[model samples]
Target: MKRKQPLLLVIIAFFVLSNFIYNVPNIEAATKLDIKAKAAIIIDAKTGKVLYEDNADELLGVASMSKMLTEYLVLEAIHEGRISWDQKVTINEFVHKLSSPYLGLSNVGLTQGEAYTVKELYQAMAIHSANAATVALAEVIAGTEGNFVKLMNEKAAELELGDFHFVNSTGLNNSDMLDNHPEGTDINDENKMSARATAKLAYHLLNDFPEVLDTAKISRLKFRDGRTYNNFNWMLPELTFEYEGVDGLKTGSTNFAGYCFTATAVKSNQRFITVIMNTKSQIERFNETAKLLDYAFANFGEDTLFEKGFVPESKKTLPVTKGKDDSVKIATKDPLSLIIKNGEKDKYKAKLVLNKKKLNEDGQLTAPVKEGDVVGYLTYEYDGDDLGFITDKESTVKVDVVATESVEKANWFVLMMRGIGNFFASLWNGITTTVGGWF
Candidate 1:
């Protein structure tokens, strides 16, 4: 009896230990990553796939992050030849007063009656988050900060950045502007944007003006007067919150914004953008961003689900009405590459959409089919919680599908025979229906 009792106790202990070990990882996997912020989002930089989001669409103050749009406009003007980097800009008395160190705002002191080149002010604005430098650049571009705000709003609309409003170029709380707030805006107005919209702005900024990183990545910049300023983004190398592959982007903080950051990083050739808004503190923003980024890099990798020229089994051939061949083989014009979560590959499926303009009334190609002709689009579907693209609510990421080989027009006699056969088939169907009705 004693030996049997010991055997029974051993069995029970073994079962309990095995179950505890098995459930530990399952519990951690279920929780995944959690970001502590008012709003947050992480997305693939190239494909705009939303990996994770929490209250990303809730509008919140953006603080100096508004300068990203201003930065965009400045780059656009330079590219369009409307402005030059070497062009000298005189600091107005208003900006000079606003830039005084006495105010304790982030700035590079600007002296009145001294002209600074556009590039100098840009470096100050980009590297130091200098408010006065931002306003100076705005004035150079639009003759006044108020007019520049108009351009900012217009560009925001054009970019389709929903849930955004630009009240000023500097993104300063109108109250902080010391009674010099831009015209047509209330004194309390501050730039506001949802995390999603901010991500979109960063997307466009990187795609349209990739060189912004050249400046954004600079950790320290020296003004002509010899005052050096360090970048506020501590994620940069040698900074306090350094993270591998961390690069150019923007950071904002205010009484209302509560430490917002738009951060981008690349690892193993895969790039991701993360936005954290309204974190508890400056360090908390970077800590939360690190958590989000680690989640992305550790759990996701670049995958080629379908290679170029690959054809879907269900949609391998498109019918041709008058071509020598009755059908044409179609394949993807480009590879379908995505940064997807590991082990979730089976949940995705390709969706092919044929071009309606290329099809005839019978839903077949009309005549000669040329090689490499665009016949449709190849998109994908994931049976998971898809937060959708950051740029738009309903837009789907897709690639072009095209014909793999040419199908020349059929001979005149062959076309005539096919037409005759189709006509007879239609007539026979009609005659059978009429006879049935009589019965």
Candidate 2:
């Protein structure tokens, strides 16, 4: 009967252990985001958390902001040694036409016969929105805008920008084409960019070409031998509205796109990405963004939602019998984080529950146990509702469950003892083996 005490305790402990593990993560300490915009999303660039958002996946034309992608591709070429900053590019009619509403010029005063460095022309495209420079760089990279666009589409597909479709490197609506013109003749990518994707693209751009920001950060940049163009993104110099961290990206204001802006700000050791579309006025774009930025900086501070190797002990590390290895350590393949509401930091919580019996036996698990293999799953509950499985929320975070180690069975004596021992001994051995791991 004394032997029965521990065995009874094991059963009681099993049931009790789950009681604490499965309850909702604490939420009395979290904050909520207060945002009002046609479309908006605020994400923590470090952990890729979608801090706040609206219509993040909705298609929207980004206008000049499309240049963010262009900048990424150009910088990619430069990094790959495809072209140098000083390489001379011959001027053409397309380069000449850049003077029209492109380079902030009705027409840039480029002489019919002249050559410019790849660096100078690109600066005009990036800073001044020079159409000619866009075409020139496209030609240099792939010999034609059409080819470069093919490259653009390929990159889009690779980045999984499902809502993305690139018809021209310039992102202009080609009136010459379009069998069905009733789509309102929207220029550029036609569909508006969601607040989330803008954030994703901005994050990608910064990671890809920080140098672009170096130039975009410039309040006033000059080109074309004399004509100077000020950044249309007027938030740079504590400007008329005090856009302190306001840096470069692209701004669009076609009748259809209606003042699109993708803005990034860094303060308090945390960086934020915001996208606002179809604002009533250019100033509203700046004003709304400033409000968003201020809220993010003041109300939201950085939290380590995920560290490269932070696996809470709650993750499943099941014991195993004889096999190729000793034990199996499983964890969520992807790093997890929270994009909590503006004021709800303390309210954020996580709980891990292991699905023990469901895991296969034969003292074996299914093949393909990656380092981050998930033997079980964890649910992320915000405010006490089951969020189901946390797959890709915005399709940006990538992760897969991998097995940390292969499980080899215990020695013959241990297995024999496991079979003969009533229950407590088996339980004790399982715990020790699971905790101590393979010898």
Candidate 3:
């Protein structure tokens, strides 16, 4: 009994340490980050997960953060072979007009007919947030700013960059453009993308054009002469967090938007992309985003929370009926994981727990299906209060359930008739053959 008591005590101690005494490391939370931004958001870049936000859905002028969308379309154009970075873009009168020093735009310094590579324009637009270069690239890619705006809206809709009904690539307050008039007046209540979409946009740009960082990382770049400019963001190595992993993102500010930042940081094998819109000052944006990142690193981590496959224990397996195989197994298309506070794994337990009504027996999609389709959702939940709805409860990721290999072209009406016909024919043939054999 004495020996047993000692063993029980050890077991209890192990559970206590794993579950309680040794909790998830507490990283410094947002410290003295008191600033009144109209909007803000922090996100997990890799998973396209939103971790934090303050009025993230409120639409407001995003300011230079608009550059991220411009960069996204430019890269897409490059990827689709519509344009190349090496291709030279022409500098026109219109392009020259947007390059006002008062506007705080960097210049490409192009003489009429003097050509610069699309690559250089990309750098200018991305690194310097140069208005002239942005217009120049837009002209080259879509042949006009109007056309580029069309493409931008189309792409924005496609990406679901929330609540925007305006023209103009620069999110600068355009008070007079009648095309989509009445821009949301309340900066705190301004039109904006959700933190998830904004973060995803930032995530795409940086991950796609890692080279953009080489230029963005440089705090100053000279243009047109010895004209040197400094980065608008104050969250670099100089601050308290001194986030070494931080690099290459845009910052925004306007009386309405206040001070906003879409920041990307990399630590170990993980990356976090954050957005803070309508902040009080550049320092506030920096420090707030840093705290968000610190919290993410301390709690959540990137690991396969749930993988796509047979549910194993669930009654997930179903009959294929007319398909090639017996039945399809329902599971995740890709694994869902989190960068969550430690022992918060239970929060995920309810997440990976899926609903059957949302799935089909095919384990993929039910019907009216196309290959490479989206079938269900990966729901996540976070019960932690300090982290809020960021890392703990996540945006529902889509689940692509697969259909069986058998392609049944007929709809339900035809399938029913066909099934009946086949059954009757098989029965008739069996009866006739059996009778003949007996005779």
Candidate 4:
């Protein structure tokens, strides 16, 4: 009997262990990326939600990526009528000298005396990353590369690029100083920006002037001189590395700033902007971008939680005090959405939170509630207490809850009638209860 008891105990322990193991939830781990770069960031283009990041705030030379801001300013100028696309710009000796192949800088081979339209120069800067063309366009807008750089810095500040500073319109290293430089030129000045800040700049660039994509997405284009210049961004189809949905953005490299790329890809109405900086080689930059894009598109997507003027079916009515209507319907003032990761939808939850201060002593809203009057907010949560599932990464969007119907104040006669009806109903309920107890 004693030996049998020990065996029985062992069996009981085994079953307990097995039950625990079987019931444990298998939660997938967060996605891990093996990115080989000094700094990197991936963000949703529209919402600016950061999906992935590593050392994204480390300041480093951005090289030709600075030209993106240059391109933005040029586009802004064009839109504001400061410059026209067809307006011809004369190339100065300084531009020609820097563009010379001997200078070891990227150029579209503009001659000192040659004239090109603003459109041609903009294309060269946007697609080919022609430093000379960038400088020429800057000179035309702000009078000098230094002045133009000032505008770039100002705009960067306006955009809240905390870690960005532009030393020159062209992202050329200050070490590459030319003889008899311009008066305001800083021989050692170079553009410095963090990957995070650069992503913000790229976001605004794409949003403000989408026309830049018309030039940026072009894999190749002919200069006014008929010389073909292929885009430096390898993510395009015309280049060796062909990433689907990758259209336009920018690429940068220098002795100081290793291969860097700010890439954007859109698939099924979802767009992502990824920035990789200080990578070892051009191939690695594009490859790392592909990894980031793949991870974003596969795992993360935008989900609209509520549409504009959407009211929750549950608890849609709030009690009204001394009003024509006993209750008022409420709903969200604007659409609410979230960039949820895969497998998180089931964990999503939303609750309508009313403004208690807006209520009277009776715990009901006061009369004269107008439609569209903000009464509270719709708060959303995901897996609030459940760690057994993968949930949103600690992000929430609150939508304004507003009254959907107007409730005018109750008139004196209406208030008297409601009081009399409430008194009679209470008296009848008490009398019925007393009589039933006697029975």
**TM-scores, one per candidate:** 0.92, 0.68, 0.64, 0.81
lDDT of 1: 0.90
Q: Which consecutive 10 residues in model 2 have the weakest lDDT in total? A: 176-185
TM-score of 3: 0.64
Ranking by TM-score: 1, 4, 2, 3
Tens digit per residue, CA lDDT, model 2, 61-133 = 6666777777788899999999989999888765555544533431245544588888887777776666567
**Poorly placed runs, candidate 4 (over 4 Å):** 1-30, 177-186, 307-316, 333-335, 351-366, 371-379, 382-400, 412-439
Model 1: per-residue lDDT, tens digit, 184-264? Answer: 999998999999999999988998999999999998888876787889999999899999998969999999889999999
Residue 216 of model 2 has an lDDT of 75
lDDT of 1 at 273: 92
Judge candidate 2 at residue 281 and give its lDDT.
81
Off by over 4 Å in 1: 5-7, 14-32, 393-396, 419-439
Candidate achieving higher TM-score, 1 or 4: 1
Model 1 TM-score relative to the real fold: 0.92
**Compared with the true structure, what per-residue lDDT tens digits does model 4 show for residues 1-439?**
9879989999999999999999886553345588999999888887677778889889998999989999989999999999999999998887888888787788888898888999988999999999888889989999977778778889998877789878887788866747533346567767889998899899889888988888889999887677888899988986899899999799999988999999999999898999999999988999999999999999889887777887877778889988999999888998888777877777777677878889877779989899888888886767733321111332345788999989999999999999999999999999999999999
The local distance difference test score of model 3 is 0.62
Query: Can you write out model 3's per-residue Cα lDDT over 228-290, one digit (the tens) per residue?
Result: 655665555553435778776887666666777888778898887777776677778777777
